[model samples]
Target: MFSEPEEPTATRMRRARATACAALKVEDAAQNPIWGYAGRTLSGLVHGSEEDGWLRVVSETAARAGGRLWEGPRTASFALPASVPRPALHRIHDWTEEGWSYRAELYAYAPASVVSPGPVLDTDLDLSEAWWAGLGTALDALAAVPTDRVSMREEYIRRAVAEFTGHAVGGIPWSTAHGDLHWANLTGPELLILDWEGWGRAPYGFDAALLHIYALRAPETANHVRKTLAHFLDDPAVRVAELTVCAQVLQAADRTPFYAALADPVRRYLKRMGRGAV
Candidate 1:
């Protein structure tokens, strides 16, 4: 004979309550449900399914990191300013169990945008020229301000140059930067840029160089990026050199996994940067 044990519905509800009670400071724990579509990340994407509406659970690790980065309450206390268009943080909570404790945040989920499935390099959108001009404008504005007045640190500048100087010929002009700008991080129409974790001022061409090097996979496209940049920046050879260095540094850091996934031409650019081949 065989026997199995099953909890009654009331017992199951109690268990669920205990779990929620341990995790959150509940003003109320009503069954408020929500749904989420799958979103992509550097690691991979979690797909949405019909069986369960997407649960926006913030784990302890994420709560801790957010607290460290934002220097505030871990959960349910505050929200980022509305001026920012990235994902919204709904609430934060702490969960405790035997010998373990963790923090987490609940987030309002937005449907994933319908993104083009082509390689970043081959996208025919070809705003290389516009992007180039925008970058130049941004750089010129940044450079007009004295470095001492800006928040940029000398060490950061040096590291930027050192990271890419091998491939580029000379120094680029210094300026403030968005730090990270890529197609994936951008939203259409609104041009809302997210993930401000690393935002700061840096050299003038740093963002453009990063985008060109990482997104333009084909040599022809890369050449186009270079031409656009040169034209927009008025063919400033010194600036180009500096930008190349910055690009190399970005490629090396490989923060976005897309850069790591690139094939030979991309790798070659990085290698050239290391050797100052440009």
Candidate 2:
């Protein structure tokens, strides 16, 4: 079978940075440097620009839920109010410079990420119960606010779960979620969620479910998440959320090593859920 060649990282980074600089009106800024690079997007601190901020440049075709979550691609983010503890957005711009199109979002820079970006985090957090306490705090804060954003409904979950296990789950609760909740998008030494492009209303326990799914690689961490979010996860709706996320990672196992590692545990989980033993 033939596969398309992946674009070289250096080439992608330079193009992304160039688009970011142009859109941010800081094309000549000399202090700019790459802070992080996920597959289709790159973020860095901007300098010599009229405004001080962190810039995130992403490919246009990338699946971004921010548009619906924040009310469109050109609009500023106001849905996440002060209590959420996320970076404040400064501006947003979308355009096709050269042949490829892009969307650039500038935000106030955050100090650091809790763990390096990837499927698994190996850092010894030496975290206290207070750190775990923040998860519940953040989720409660998010749930208190209502939004017109799109819902991450159970039908989607049912389809995804059915794709793998030939079973469907229904009637899950819905609420706003940090759609891409995972260690990579979180910063610590202090808790700050990064990468808002996917924030929107999702299944009620979706964020914690995704986080726990990722933590399955570390049983202790997974247990910690389960215990902390037990208030919500105890709801049957939330169990469906966990199963939905597991189905997703299991379905995407070929693309990343992280998902590959999740296979067995997810399979075990599905089996239990299927038997109504969860």
Candidate 3:
């Protein structure tokens, strides 16, 4: 039972109309179709603009970098670059009445080829261990890429480590990280990682730490994850230190609403580690 804010009806209609107009401009099939307003969070509301024969409109507040923050529209445009996930970008407009909006080029929403059991919030220590093991494999795959090839911000990485490690205790390991790796951002049975807005290179353990800390709110689950992660690495101490830094940076960012659910011990641990770097 989450208490989510309701988007106004007039605003919904405006968004729907905008999606419809954008669809027509793109020469997508179907003129009039049912529109639905999806979930709203601290970031912004998700609206399914129009679902006709061939296309659908999915729009929301554009998320920011450095952290998982949402800022209003920076600029308006009809076509977005290939870097954007969608096929075509219809129109980008700023509305004083309705924040920034963009209509993605229409695409069919396909059902997942395989669907796992719905997310189980309570701890399944065994399952968590397996998940962590899989996560490690993913991280290793990500890390194999040469650092120079990836578009990682050196300043950001420097600041992150400097903020977390007062003195250079030891050199930090480098790798590309998802930046924010959480369940909600992931979609489909294929688990194709979506929401690449916060993606960039970071220290090796950042993604693992973020995922572990988020999952470890439950003591049993946290311990299980830690154990799983331990099996993957050569140096447990360094992994712990990296995880500490990730927890602190994540806590400071205040990205997830579920932060409130984190346990006091974990919170205290993060605060202690964060103080060392900041």
Candidate 4:
């Protein structure tokens, strides 16, 4: 171990982080660690510099082993374009400790900071044309690949789109997506995508629509997103993708007040498309 491994605690985030650090042969970064959303799965992440001078990100995720969530990141790490501008996975350590399956992943630290602390983009970003080009290229490349998993179930897509829009959809264009795409999972100044734990196939333009939904509160940013990913967002075939994401946000809003703000905007958007009777 490069550092003394802390005792594993099933409930505490730091314990998992420390254990992962030790297993990955890394120490804590200069700054504090970041935690993901509070959920049934307990997880935490921190970054540090490796002996090789490359920045290393160590994260511990608690979930059932042999499932999609358990395998997504490791699968994406090897499957994605390594030459692209994103963190490169170097090593991984997974084991069952304290009656829970814990996965620790070590990735080359992303080159730029995340655009937003939360899923919603609350502020404007002065992204360059080159940045937009890079993002388009990356997303395009990602969409071209095939995958075994799926981000959204075909049955769910059909139900949600029909229930939300009062219109049925056929031949929904399916493609690979980052799945949980939002400003929080993207970097500023550069376009390095993060958190690949949910990557899988979905409706074409799903990623862009998700990001755009998050940016609705920030009109300038929202418009900028539309302008940038217009190729995906503007196509008539992408209506199902847009409706699918909006329905998801509406459903989430119903469950928690945190997502409430996005619900009305999505409703209006659906209504404008001659749908949204529901």
Query: Against the true structure, whose TM-score is highest?
Result: 4
Candidate 2's residue-wise lDDT over 1-278, tens digit each?
Answer: 01222566447656767767776776433353444424455666676445556777666443443355333323215766666667777777776644556677777766665564574543334556876787689877876667666546556777887787666665667788877777876777677776665566777788888887787667787778789988777777787678778878888888877778778888887776664422
Clashing pairs in 4: none
Model 1 misplaced stretches (Cα beyond 4 Å): 1-122, 126-172, 218-257, 260-278
Model 1: ten consecutive residues of lowest lDDT: 35-44
Q: Which pairs of residues have clashing backbones in candidate 2?
A: 114-187, 114-188
> Relative to the true structure, how large is the alpha-carbon lDDT of every model?
0.41, 0.67, 0.42, 0.71
Best-first order by lDDT: 4, 2, 3, 1
Task: Report the alpha-carbon TM-score of model 2 versus the true structure.
Answer: 0.81
Give each model a TM-score.
0.44, 0.81, 0.51, 0.85
lDDT of 1 by residue, 41-93 (tens): 11111222321111233222232333322322221122333333454544444
Q: Can you write out model 4's per-residue Cα lDDT over 85-189, one digit (the tens) per residue?
A: 677777877766565566676666554777777787667778888887887788888888779987789999889778766667778888898898887778878
Model 3 compared with the native: what TM-score?
0.51
- Model 4 gets an lDDT of 0.71
Cα lDDT of candidate 3 equals 0.42
